[model samples]
Target: MTVSFTETEAFKTFFYAGEIRLLYFLMILMAIDIFTGLAKALKNNKLWSRKSLFGYARKLLIFCIIVLANIIDQILGTHGGILFVTIFFYIANEGLSIIENCAEMGVLVPQEIADKLAVIKNEKGTSVTTEIKEEFTSSHSRDLEGDTAEVKIKIEKD
Candidate 1:
């Protein structure tokens, strides 16, 4: 029998009251964050495709997390409480990031934001990968335990 998606329980659950709205709101926040981030990057002349790629990857991960939350809610019969909380958490995080980006664009920024921007300017991007790469390459490669990444990259042909 050919089945239509709208005839399925999954479709009903997917369109459950308020859940789709929350999802749309989260999407809107994510888009706004990207827009503000791009504006900030342009203002600072710091545009990079790598950063944009990572940003989209992070947004995808956010959606995955929310979907996981919804799955949990279904399993536990909490009626989407966990999913709503997950969505709201991302909303707040995205909102704060938008504020920070606006601050970089020279909006009415707070002193704390100004101080943070100053620090960011002096320091390179603060991704953990960047930090670890710097740690292994810098003169200060040795950690407190005198440890450093010692392996070199090589490919062995099969």
Candidate 2:
């Protein structure tokens, strides 16, 4: 006896009608970008219109690029593997950009993690054992006193 299971309605809903996990993550990223941009503007006491515009443009471009890639994949009759690869590359790039933008707002990201990501971007491939080594080292080790990251803020008094 053979059992055949087709894609569920729930999966189809997420892929087309609803939000996929990556899309939800991207939405969170967008919120962070907007909040950080607003915080920076307020901190500097500057009423810059470009900041919001820039953040919006980034979000729009990311979505547009992903959609375009999906369209191309459909035309070429390629499975979503190609689209997923494109999404992965863009996700990493956008993640890096988000970190940089947050850093600009005085939210410091861990140096070691950032450096590791930079290395990954540059390096070819890591051996299985090497991946474990990369995960253990962190510049913000102190922040993870127990198991969670505790962000420290140094406020200036006028």
Candidate 3:
């Protein structure tokens, strides 16, 4: 006898919650981040047993947060807004970490790009990743208040 799609564990865990794609993407990012991180650590001879375990635990916690956000969306009778935003935030973070890991392995990232990534990662808040977006928007608006013509000239020069 064939089981219905909804009867499967994968469906219940992911499709039912409308987060299968986001979860899958997050998992992929997590795996890449972990592999890059481990490679960097091994290169530097700093791969502590407890630290690696803690890093895995932290990834698990990130998954739990996405699950919690999905539940929150359900309770509010909304779609996947919360879960999507949460996953997107984590994805950006993991992507930045991967880049940093690659740089640590002597991959030669541009200094300006590395500095900007460092600023984003070092932002302190309950949602540092989210705050980076807000800060960027605000900074852009502030820039607009200064001479738009001058900015245009600067952009043209660049």
Candidate 4:
């Protein structure tokens, strides 16, 4: 007996929203992030088996969320908006983590480059990927101020 094409897992996955290249890039970034994180942890003598398992589980959950976002996009008759946004968010998040891991490993990353990666976003009222690129480019030269905390003191003398 022969199974129909629609009855195959490949067909179902192929119909998921978003371009294949985006998914490929996400996978690459995730792998890099995991590797760097492990290296950093090992360097600090803080590597734990349970923490590694948790990291794997987190990556699995990310893929599941992307699938759900793709389904939502299909239900809304849209072309990969949810999928794109979800993937973009993860990519930026993982990229930032990878950068931090590198820093922890004693790799020097320029402040401007780190700042650019931190500001990568898919803002409302703009093209998804385009806005991310634009923001990264523009944020590089922008100064980011540190948040300030206020302290109060009261003294009474009689």
Highest lDDT against the true fold, candidate: 4
Model 2 reaches what TM-score against the true structure? 0.53
The regions of model 2 sitting more than 4 angstroms off are 1-19, 114-158
Score every model by TM-score: 0.64, 0.53, 0.65, 0.64
> Candidate 3: what lDDT?
0.73
Task: State the lDDT of candidate 3 residue by residue for 1-158, as single tens digits.
Answer: 99978568665455346656666787899999999989988999988776677678879888778777777777676777776788889988888878878876889899997777666564352235435434555455686685645333334553
RMSD (Cα, Å) for all candidates, in order, is: 10.7, 19.2, 11.4, 13.4
TM-score of 1: 0.64
Ranked by TM-score from best down, the candidates are 3, 1, 4, 2
TM-score between model 4 and native: 0.64
lDDT of 4 by residue, 1-158 (tens): 99966557564454445666887888999999989988988898989776677678879888888888877877786676777888899998888778767865879889897566445533553234334434544354363346567899999999
Task: Give the clash count for each candidate.
Answer: 0, 0, 0, 0
Candidate 2 global CA lDDT score: 0.60
For model 1, give the 10-residue run with minimal summed lDDT.
121-130
> Which digits, one per residue and each the tens of the lDDT, describe model 1 over residues 82-137?
87788889998787778767875878988886676556443454533335435654
Q: Between candidates 2 and 4, name the one with more favorable lDDT.
A: 4
Model 1 backbone overlap count: 0
